[model samples]
Target: MAGLFANDSEQIDRRTSRSICDAVGERLQQSLRPEPRLPTHLEQLLDELKQRDRDSH
Candidate 1:
């Protein structure tokens, strides 16, 4: 009797692998595009603190 399962590593080609990777990457990029930008008030406060520290040192 022959076994029903076999290894499929030999059947995959470079082109197919690259195509799958590219599709998954595109989906991820689309999902991340709408993320909100950072808050400007927090950014300005951090910059001011850094400048004060630099002047003291």
Candidate 2:
């Protein structure tokens, strides 16, 4: 039945948003010229994650 296989709207929206974020992140990683240190990259990733958390609320 259509009901059994239908995707929830909210679920679809979340998946789309996640996929976009991942694609953008990948593009950024590929475009960066200087290879940053491990700690620097980790800190930036943490900051981006924190910003996303704040934006969601």
On TM-score, the leading prediction is 1
Worst 10 residues of 1 by lDDT: 1-10
Where is model 2 poorest over a 10-residue stretch in terms of lDDT? 4-13
Give per-residue lDDT, candidate 1, residue 17: 84
lDDT of each: 0.84, 0.84
- TM-scores of all candidate predictions against the true structure: 0.49, 0.37
Query: Each model's number of backbone clashes?
Result: 0, 0
Residue 32 lDDT, candidate 2, scale 0-100: 86
Task: Tell me the spans in candidate 1 whose CA falls farther than 4 Å from its real position.
Answer: 1-10, 13-15, 27-37
Query: Which residue pairs clash within candidate 2?
Result: none
Off by over 4 Å in 2: 1-12, 35-57
TM-score of candidate 2 on Cα atoms, chains taken together: 0.37
lDDT of 2 at 46: 93
Local error of candidate 1 at 20, Å? 1.2
